[model samples]
Target: MMRALCLTGDPVADKLLTDDPFALLTGMLLDQQFAMELAFAGPQKIATRMDGFSITKIAESDIEEFVELCVTKPAIHRYGGSMGRRVHELALHVVENYDGDTEGIWTAGRPKPDGPEVLKRLKALPGFGEQKAKIFLALLGKQRGVQPKGWREAAGAYGDRGSRRSIADVIDAKTLVEVRAFKKAAKAAAKAG
Candidate 1:
């Protein structure tokens, strides 16, 4: 069910995970304290802030004003009281520590430098937590092996009714069967050898 609803594969959303480092980081900053749909709005609001977010502009902006800008929508959908301020601080922190170079986040020596690493880095930012990091990574492609952890428990816990557990109860059931058969065959072949 998750795979089915996500069939077209969410490519545009996937790019947020690894392709464009700056945008991904920006989205992560905006993601804090909002729903999945709302958190994504942070990046969209930022494009007009400068000439394609040239980095210098964000670093130079009066974060207080930028935070006010972040208060407009998605970020404001939930506990939006101070979302603007949060976004402002996040951007400033990025610029201050990374020299506005968002991609430097991947140092090449840590934990395979994969999607999870990206999540780890983003989570390290202020205002970003586990859920924010996971949602941000979800936009990437679900490829980084990052998944919404509470989804299953939420379903059973609240009877979420939306759990699709009925449908996706066993993802790749056929594939699992095939894998088991392959393992059996390989084991037999090895024993015979």
Candidate 2:
């Protein structure tokens, strides 16, 4: 069994993330320009509104209707419409490439993929840039037990042990605060320089 994610304080949202690989990926895709916990909870909101979460359903959904779903009330992100489209595109990419097996990105192929290979696969996904790919790889290694050889190196700074640098290090409320602090400091330092 996969370990439960504590990204969102809400039990339902966190449970959805834990139970669904696609949901976890969606959350990571939504993590940009939004509060991390709320971003992670976006999948749960979609699951609730749509009656269940399915990557196929999301990919096949009418773009306008899907945008509406994302824009409804609380919304999936601050920029709901754009993020919704990105989510749709991500679903399509995964379906077309992995045949709906989200884990296949890491677990597929002869002799199994190593960390660099998995990172390359993640970088190919829609909305996953180099930094985002590295962070997700770190999350998989630290929490989801998707560690492949050289995972730590592929993940860069985010994979360092006990480092509260990104969502990968957030195991609880305390860690979330630590990550936020780290980001805030980094942003401040960048501005200062």
Candidate 3:
């Protein structure tokens, strides 16, 4: 499963590493409605424009500008007429509690809450529901202390609920090791050739 994730270019599946946890949280929030590809593009574009789109920069940004960028340039999530306002709310929420600092927000939320508790807290946010909440928990859990809702159970429950959410089970760590070894040997053989 880990190999499949790495092989697939899905960034969410990629083991994301961040010194600033708020950035991960914010990026995950953008992913709620945005297609994965577009969602991946949003932060990069923002970072390019601001020279570094950190939580502080985003929180300090005028809501009008955030809305404008959300709607027009490098548009990722389509929140209809509601995109700007919703993101404004999210940015403000982060700022109010986190002093507009990415590291601070993550740390405040840190020592990482238990998986279920983390899910509950995130669901309390304005736009999130069970599915979105699960997605964030799953993604963040992979990198942090949280765990993906046991894969089989999440899939069964989500499927019953008609949820499109795909939780992974059986991460094939060995496959990754094997594939990497194969690649190394192939590279060596080619070089020898």
Largest TM-score belongs to which candidate?
2
Clashing pairs in 1: 13-139, 14-140
Task: Please provide, for model 1 over 1-193, each residue's C-alpha lDDT reduced to its tens digit, 9 standing for 90 to 100.
Answer: 1232211123444333234456555555554334332344445445544445445666577876666555555443364547656655666777887777765554434344565565677678777777555444453333223233333232231123222212111123453344346546866999999
Could you tell me which residue pairs clash in candidate 2? none
List clashing residue pairs in candidate 3: 1-172
Estimate, for each residue in 1-193, the C-alpha lDDT of model 2 and write its tens digit: 2478899889999988988899999999999989999999999999988989999999999999999999998999999999999999999999999999999999999989999999999999999999999999999999999899999999999999999999999889999999999999999999999
TM-score ranking of the models: 2, 3, 1
Q: What lDDT tens digits, residue by residue, belong to model 3 across residues 137-193? A: 554444344343443244234223223233212124443345346546866999999
lDDT of 3: 0.50
TM-score winner between candidates 1 and 3? 3
Q: How big is the RMSD of model 2?
A: 1.0
The 10 consecutive residues of candidate 2 with the worst lDDT sum are: 1-10
lDDT of each: 0.48, 0.94, 0.50
